[model samples]
Target: MRRRISVAETAPTQPGTTGSFTTGEWWRDAVIYQVYPRSFADGDGDGMGDLRGIEERLGYLSELGIDAVWLSPFYRSPQADGGYDVADYRDVDPLFGTLADFDRMLQTAHELGLKVIVDIVPNHTSSAHPWFVEALESPSGSPERARYLFRTGTGAAGELPPNNWSSVFGGSAWSRVNDASGEWYLHLFDTSQPDLNWRNPEVVDEFKSILAFWAERGVDGFRVDVAHGLIKHDELPDFEGITGEMLEGGGNRGPMWDQDDVHEIYRGWNEVLKAFDGDRMLVAEAWVAPAERLSRYVRADEMQQAFNFDFMTVGWNAGRMRDSIQSALATNRAVGATTTWVLSNHDVVRHASRFGLSDPSAWPKGISATDEQPDSALGVARARAATVVMLALPGSAYLYQGEELGLPEHTTLEAELRQDPNFWRTAGVDIGRDGCRVPLPWKGDAPGFGFGPSGSTWLPQPASYSELAADRQDGDPLSTLELYRRALLLRRELQLGRAELSFNASTGDTLDFTVAGVRVLANLGAEPVELPSHHEVLLVSDDAAVDAGQLNSNGSVWLR
Candidate 1:
């Protein structure tokens, strides 16, 4: 496959009116820190980041600097699709914690000046869920059947999927309960996550109940998963350009990807969020959407924000970073909605080791005596550059859990044993996300990846993580961990993420620009380049050793 290229144009970098941007208080300038619980700090010696563990780590979040925290789903699940296959919307799975534990987390997070946002899987419930179970046994017109998108009397029939669309996880988008009814349920990702029929009024009201369930629990907001794929064509149109990847296992195409119907559904959800006025935030995960197309979901009547992966998609080059930032700004402004920056997430390789900044022969796990270390100062410099670019850009800056510590990518295939379902799906063809999702290193010498020494862990801990653990580097003034703290603190101190871009231009690999007159610059290159006396320096990655005349490697500065 040649790979599909996105057709999104970049945006300008000019400062506009203050209230000119969307006036939503919850996210106007908030930093959404994403916590992949399984890999975060493990509490209870389970090697998993449980609710109580997250509660204990709230101070780490506040200290690192962030306005909101987006927790990946912890709901009751069967692990067929992580916790995304929700068995119950209102309960936390035992693997993570209980419902009450979640309550304390939200309560305390709010008390700490941080907002608690949970993942909302509105599109489907686990096949094992009570409603799905009952619907499996019921006849048409039954009340339980109304909860899902169940269609009958079609062939290719139950053996085939509901449509020609493809599941993102590979295989057909649909699955059959039996041959008797000869109908299939739709799943956009995995078969376990049956796509809900949003056209059904009952489904709408029921989700209203689900939303209220969390909002009532004192949760601040939600990170909407696959938000754009919610609504189908209403006719479930045939999927076009289906490839071998799309036909991984069987024959079912899932959601109406990038279709307009999704916009209507988002608008509906925003209507529900409006009930909370400007207090609630709605951030959608739309990976392929361009700024122009994505803005449709962020209108005042639609969504509060959408995840902006511009930097995430670009190569780790200063020129690219500068262009991406400027283009993203110009595109979003043209579309009438600004973007929220997303540098890394659970799905991709850690940027610390992925950018190939070092010699190709020294690939992390394959390191030899002569090659540079995987997270060499060069790597650290690039990671820090990524931070400066993210924090100084307009809109929200999201920080993934380990990114603050500049956590390196895993060096061993042993990380495979950590129980990532994506790995199980391929039976080893792909490096399971388990490496990135490993237990967080807290105590340097503690076993279970410092989840605890001699403590039980849900996943096997990495042996080499001691150097990267919080215990070892917290006080080290030159460590990557300290630099992250400074980057986040810098983000907070300037409010530049909230301020519009006043200026941006060529200054070596440095993406030099200004926000609210705070001139910000970052050198994406490992070897920094100096700039003319164009502006003064406000903040650099605290780790970088450089002067105003010479932006010597990993250098970042914000001018007043």
Candidate 2:
């Protein structure tokens, strides 16, 4: 419906032995780990986390050399906002289990080669979804209340709320409908959820039949949820001075968000993910703004990837991380697409306590045990030098579940065991996202550290998560889960996700570059630097004092 295509010969390249084009679309440069399924791994001991606790942690995400896992929303939810309020995009959520435990956890994450990706909210549902309880007993403009965004109310007699759009978990984004037939629905997040109507064709054949019922049950893609808010602005306008600041990407041209009819609903969800043959992908948690309008949701045909969030909201400087990775590789190379890189997810702050606080751009939207605590050993040394500069940056890199055990953000959570709807829609003075959604500790020392087997953890795992447990840094070679398992096994023995980075001439506060030719560096100065004339170190977030040639200060290297 919006056709502006050119996917560069159906995109997928990855064969590289050094020639540098790299897209064998295994999500082009794949490292993707995210999880957050009720705080990953609780296998039936039931402190939550299920799907047989992610099939007993698919061998700990295939020994952390992750190639794909995503998860985040075990569907059928009533967990209000945690599961992003969904209600049944075809089942699961008996608190996460069954559809035969999600086909035995997608057949053990495709027998451990991994690739799962799930989470597809489609801009709202779960007002107890039976089509929102039959559009709350239908009749308003019936057709079962035209699949959602209900309307019909605008002041006195009708009683206000047909405009001034708000609620991203705060207040008035419509709601009203309790009978008297005065109607009003919308819900840009939580009045139990609602909001569907993408100009309803029965909400586009019920999400293309919920994306062919999870791509015929193999599910290799779809992170969508609020992917640029499903088509709005046909009229309901009235947004002046809406300082919700477009939820942080800050440009705020909000007509209920990035809506060029939401790229014809992602080119009809990239034709339901190219009718699945398993190369399937989708990625857009689109908080769209100056980040080159997220390259029209990864255009070529639509959504092949979209989550740079301007390199996860830039600011741990080095010329603002090389101008936000050269404006996200010139806006995803103007649409050929594939440039993901992330740092911290489950909605923010755990770039190891936002790189030890002191105003890492005032991270706000919730974080307050009287705030200012950060600096836990300088936030695990700049979150281990920002995960070796986001896994040597070339393309895909997601990793959020416990940040490979470098966990951090439990920023003092306790307002009655808080649970994020941005802190009950700001009633508690915004201390939400339950300190980066706590819960994963995995193994000994107390209180569900093992996250189940009845240790019982539904968010409170702190005491410094017993030294970032995963059985105390699984074979700690100076841990951070063995530096993300030796930088994802040297990012696959140096294919470096199909390599090609470049940059080089940097000096103060380091960050030099190179990728196919390897190099990398980083420092972001406070101290050490001098490195270059390489030949081999391959990976080193901090080899205990690493300096025969320097690089330390918040360290990160990769040389070769």
Candidate 3:
């Protein structure tokens, strides 16, 4: 019974008035592909991905049907926190490439009709940054020390840390400087990364200049790192009931994160973006609480987008997913901003592995090799289904590198290869994120898998990766890469991103919705479920055969 509904059929085309993409507000519903430079490709065979690698891969991204590429930081650094500990905001790290290499990458991307968004870390700077170096040299209470959050310790001989706050990685957030004064400075992450004093006018001015420097070079936007943490409560006080759950964007509120004054900094950045010639944008990486608080970061006068962690971390339940979606959409709508949907990124476990767990309702802080492993077959199936559902939703989407190839987290990464500070600071108790950050496999049946001409990669590729390599899946109609490619192309053709989503029907076991004439259904229950009336089949997850309009359990599809 393949029932065709003519009323649901509509011509496939982009919604709204057509114009030069440059003149349009392209980011409104854009599909932005996130490129983790170190793992994407290796151009110079340095066993590390660099600007040249990204330049070479621009055509691949374009073919994947992405509107823009958001690159992780390649700024000069000690590599203390995988480029998050930025030492120089104005220069490229030699490990990644030179400024000339960056410019060429940007030029090639623009020529291919893709916008570029660079990561900007304003919340903290590497200890090697000139400002931090000068602050360390100056005595406590000096003007140089004022550039950062340096405070006097509270114990006898001032031995104890200034406050009881703990780092997101591990241990105390305040690190005692070894200068004669023996004062302490704040670092919410690694000690090699020192928090900047936003209260200081010099810190504010320096960041403004950093923004302009990149804007002049034609970057389309910025992804603000730790966007909610620049401001702190004036009185540095000890955290009383702070727990780990509260640290990673849970229902926690405190002095160090999601402060009111953070909005002001983004407002200032918004003005700078407005002054630019094109429709430049700013997206926040603020790991803030409850859906409502996340909305505050994207107010009309602030940043344009913030990662929807609520959607990303919610369990694989129909009821839970629907609730998260409704809440996110309603909240962002109040601020006149589009909701952003993301499943996984560089900092979290891949949703493929995450969904394979018995219960994926709440994301764990970290995954270790010794931990209970995921069901690989189940995980891959769910991941493919999830992609179709995500692309069918309203608002913008972010696709992490290697996800389109259906890669899973390398759960067995050796301790020696782990680089995330969370792993080192926690002393192997937490596996950190190196599993999801493994170098991508491109081709061949062995190590590196075409990541470089010399077959060398920073992180070892598993034997299992050979089947999932890009070259192997390039033309396979049933491959995850092709599924994403077709879904993305169809998303644009149907104008799904710009269309308003409506709940057509839903049940305890199944969730159904319609957007831009396409019906999206997800079967969360044990038994196969029947889809509503539609004119055509768009896509389906692994093994989900749409015979007689029935979608299999743990499967999803797009119709009409």
Candidate 4:
């Protein structure tokens, strides 16, 4: 019973062509898809995803109608925190593929007219990194030790940590070294990931070379990981305030986060991005907020875009959604930068499952198998509605892999199979993000859902995934995958990404707005709402939710 609409065909632009937009500004309203390499696909039957896996899927991404693909880190790493704990910034991990495999993937993506955005981790390095290894070998105050934050402990025998700061992954942020000096080092996340000293000139110069290294190889952009944590207070200070694994908004600023000096680092990085062709750009994965303050990171000469986490944190409420959208648009407008909208990423529980929870905002870390489960049916309906509203806004939209398939978090993942460090670090209390990062389902009946030739996956998929596999939904008009395809096609044809938003008259729990002369109506309340009269129905989030010109609860509709 799903409604379908015909969209006029338009010739596709060649790769590297920025059509209609100002030169080098394709990112302004681009729809970029986040690809977590480890969970996307496994090309070699090795029970792990690799560059060859992604290269094999370039055609799938192109067919998905995204403008660009932002790959999560696949660099050489111990993967203590996935690829965030990078050991070598310039090389691909053997667990992923060889350097040639990366080039081949990059080449294939470009040939498919998809821009490539690589993740850049600058705030820290794996303990096994050459710099960190040398720092451990060197004595206190040695030049090698200067590369990282290694300070003498405070107790009589230098036993206590230098400060009271806690790690994002739990435990003390400072870990005492076992060397002669018995010094302690800073690691904001994990013991294996050491925080680098941005005050060092060598660190700054090294990142510039790394940027140029990737830029020369034809990446269209870089998604700077932990973008706000690069520069810390010169004198590391104690922060007694409660800290979570991720910053939710602007109020959590402290010695280790959102420092003013961080802008200098990004400004220098912007200069490096400008030197490349094809409108090379940088997007910050900064969790800093108070939309106004977050604006500073996207100033003319800084990063082109920063993730708008505020929008994602706001629960399934019409007023809250409207406020977030308006605030993001107004703030970015002040800095002449376009806003970025994201519903879910690898670090958090998938939005589909979150929307199903009684208190949607309660479990950002994730849920365990024994935890209170969400209403799966309601979650998918609400997630579909939310995505429609997000896509209608005038900004760049980022889609996490499998979201278009309406994939929910693997909340039932067994504790024994969990690999997220947060789970172990918190002694299973935090549950961790492994549920959302489970390998994607591609084929319904194939081994590992066609993720690999072998019937093995790094993380097991739920039994329900077979029904939601790409092959099962490939040609089904009512399937979530098809819904995304149709929506994306309309988005490009209508130029919704470049449209301006204006709220229409609406009452409680119902959001009515217009973008580029198209009316978008979302019903968040339990009561059904009447659709705008005399307009052609362009799309609906749930087919059954719309009946007799009325949109039922947790449904959204587009009309022209």
Candidate 5:
């Protein structure tokens, strides 16, 4: 009883035929691949990855089928907060490369037709920055001290600085200036990374100038870091109803977190950034839920994209994933805006490792004896499924580096090696994101894993992934790397996964949908189930099979 698929079938475009989609037009259906430069690939033997390393691997990215590459910070800094606290905006860190090397990397990226976006930390600066140093050494805070919120002290009145907002990494958000005067500075992140004062007009100009500097050099847009923590409540105000800020004055300042008018400051950047993003594509790390509240960032005029972290914390069940998508998607539509979905980044443990696909425990089994490896078959399949799900959803999709090749995380911890402020505060709990940020294995059973000189990488390459080296698997048809190559080709070839998804829900953790005339059905169950009779099966998971008239799966099915 074969039933015809009603939708018209259009001829598909083969992979790489779009040649390489420019990051501008690529924003619509684009899948952004995020790369943390320090761990990606090393061109020099300096024990760290740099631009030249990236330039050598441009073809690999193109093959991965990402529309853009969102590279993490490489700006000059003291390595406090891993380059988030930038001292010089224009120059590359010596460990990373020179301006000439970066220019070549950008050029190579463009030549491959991939858009490039770098991390922009707007909220803070390294205390060692010229501006911050000048402010600190001066008898009185310099005029540029206004560039940051320089407060001698705020009366601990009004809801106690608005409900006493707690600092992210522990302790108070306020850091004291060790100058002749006892002035307090705001630092929502690390004390060394002091927050900038966006209220100051010059501060806005300086930030906007940085945007212009990159956009002029052909970068598509920026992945703005800690974007929501920009302009916080002024005058040390109390919370609306609550007596004070949330957990304020434990040796910290009150108004260290969210302020209402930060949106206005964002609007100014929105105006300036429009010229760079073709779709005005600036992605904010606005780490908040409730689209209505976060909608202000994408308010018909602000950010083109913000991190859709709703899905980050969700589970493996269909109902859970669906709700995560519905909230972010439906909410954005209601606000007449859009957002992007990202599962993993440099700040968190890799999703593969977290979900037990890479290992039995949530922590990475990095280069160590205690570390347990992933269920290989299960892990690779799960990674592919994650990619499929991400691409099929609406808005933009983000794929973390090495994720395309089913890269497992490296999570060994050395006693003297703990750097994240969280471990010190949380008492050995999960704090630093060391596992996901390890070096990318590129050659040999591992060629220094291609991250740096032999034995010189910032983090050790996991023994588990030596065989998964990018070079070894590149041409092998059966390699997980090849599977991703095919997946990327299929994603662009069909162009169906990039569109808005319309779901048909009847509860019961059931998800059914259609993409370009192909029917997709997933039943997160443990028993056999019969799907509607008309569809023809393209693939199925578990022991289920498509026979005669009925489709069966306890997992998933793609049909036509």
Candidate 6:
């Protein structure tokens, strides 16, 4: 039942000629790897990951078989929200590298045959940004103020916030300014990040220029941060209920979150992307609800792809996962856009740890040492199985940097060392995203695990990281890193990304599907499932799980 398939011998049709594949549509089924600059690798020995770090590691990504690299924001910032609060859209943060360093990195990534997609935070900018500083100095009705959402307070003597909207991090979304204007600015995220008034033609044109600046520098695409939040209702209204985290998409979002007008902005952005020579693309980080509404962001004239948050947040159960997949595919098919699947990212808990939780759904905000601990061994097994299933699906896929190494979150990070604004803003109720953003361990015994020469990191690494370092797993056949290498190689060889998928008969606790003549069986039940007859195994999450004709619990296998 366990058989190794030769990737070199496979000659499946290329993705360029298959399902949803049109001429020059490389993004339709590309495998993009997300690099959190602060954690990927440290090249300057400055205790932080930088552009130089990314450039030096380009070969690692190339060998990993990813089609593109999606780097989180490295724009000039005060590090208010870990670079999400950008101070200057055109320049690189000194903490990351100079503009020249970014250009070099872009050139290197392109040379490696990997497209580059940089993060663009259009919804808000850091308070340190010149526009925001000028807006603060100008009077309430001044043109500088018009570029941002500055409004008079609502209460007697203008003491209360303009509306009842809450910040996604915590507290009121409105931040009062102590100045002659005495006006309050809106910020859906951290206080340092003031929301840009999309209604202002100046703001709209400025973002278009910013996009062109990067595209001209040869960045293949952009991942629009808070893509659904650029637009808001003209009448700033109060929410019907409490708004703890607006990014959690479901049901009907309130006025400030996912307004219908947001798509208009993207439609215009699409025009900008089309003007570029390369197939420059736009990917929405929108957390909009109902698969149908989410699809609207990826229409032919709009963005090409949007992160499938629904699939990432789905529980480990097979029934829910199956439903999520079916719904996503059907909606994207209607829009003629490729579906992008993601299981882990910089924001959420790594799937490696999430899968081991007693309540896997409870840790999106994050987990702490004081909280319920995950069963690490069990989590790794389930995560591997889940990845195999995700890789076999049609369309594009995103891999969080350390996921292939089975790196778990630093769940025990102490409070004093935490840096995410979510932790401070929420008054410690939310542990924040720091645990998942810890520096990567590259070597088993090297200082700082070869993350940097200085052997220091912004966030502390757990002792367990040493065992899972990349060097330790590099050539080990049974390692998670090798498994990913093999899986990605086979995925490309079989053209699974361009293959159509069909559901097969299976019990509630199991998922059975076929893609390009290859059958994928995932056993999420408590017991093993018998394999289908007359099929040779191509790959498996765990070799021990496949024996005779049975696949063990929380295991997955591919057959042909």
- On TM-score, who's better, 2 or 5? 5
Candidate 3 TM-score over all chains jointly: 0.95
Query: How well does each candidate superpose onto the true structure, as a TM-score?
Result: 0.85, 0.34, 0.95, 0.95, 0.84, 0.95
Instruction: Answer with 3 or 4, whichever has the higher TM-score.
Output: 4
lDDT of 1: 0.67
Error of 6 at 497 (Å): 0.7
Q: Score each candidate by Cα lDDT.
A: 0.67, 0.77, 0.84, 0.86, 0.66, 0.87
lDDT digits (tens) for residues 1-560 of candidate 2: 32211212211233212111224578888888888888887888768888888888778777767877888888788786888887887888888788998898888777767778898888888899888898788787789888888888877787988888887667788878889798889887668988888887878878988888889988888888778878888997888755256455534467877877778878887887787786788988877777777787888888898888767677577777788887887788777786888878887778777778886545565566787788877777778877888888888888888888888888777788887776777688657677887778888586688887888878777798887888988865667787777677767767776677888898566788888778888887788766766356666776543566766687776777
Tell me the lDDT of candidate 3.
0.84
lDDT for each residue of candidate 4 in 215-334, tens digit (9 for 90 to 100) = 998999999988988888888888866444445553356788889999999899999888887788899988786888889999999999999988988879888888888899999999
Of candidates 4 and 3, the better by lDDT: 4
Q: For residues 1-560, could you state the per-residue lDDT of candidate 6 as single tens digits? A: 46533322232222221111234878988999999999999988999999999999988888777888999999989998999999999999889999999999988887777889999999999999999999888888999999999999988878899999988888889989998767899998899999999999999899999999999889989999988888899999888755545344443377876788888899889999888987888999987778998998999999999989889888698988998899999999998989999999999899999999997555458899888889999899889999999999999999999999999988999899999999999889888999999999999898889999899898989999999999898867677887787778778778899889999987689999999999999999888788889987778887566766888888898899
Query: What tens digits encode model 3's per-residue C-alpha lDDT throughout 207-271?
Result: 98999999999999999988888899999777774423455545446788778877878888888
The better candidate by TM-score, 2 or 6, is 6
Best-fitting candidate, scored by lDDT: 6
RMSD of each: 8.0, 22.2, 3.3, 3.0, 5.8, 3.2
Residue range 1-560, candidate 5, lDDT tens digits: 64422111211234443235533445756778888888888887777888888888888788666778888999999886778879998879897998899889999888777888888888899888898887777654578687776666545421122224335655566776665666777676677888788888888888889988888877877898877777776665543222111221111122434456777767777788776545446888866545556666777667777777667656356676777777777778876665577777887666666555432223231332254545555544444555556655667788888876677666565735655554554454434666677778887554576566664787666676778788777766545565555545656666653556677653565557666665666654444356776555543432223333443333455566
Q: Which residue pairs in model 2 clash with each other?
A: 13-23, 13-24, 14-23, 14-24, 155-160, 443-450
Whole-model alpha-carbon lDDT for candidate 5:
0.66
lDDT of 5 at 275: 68
Supply the TM-score for candidate 1: 0.85
Worst 10 residues of 6 by lDDT: 11-20
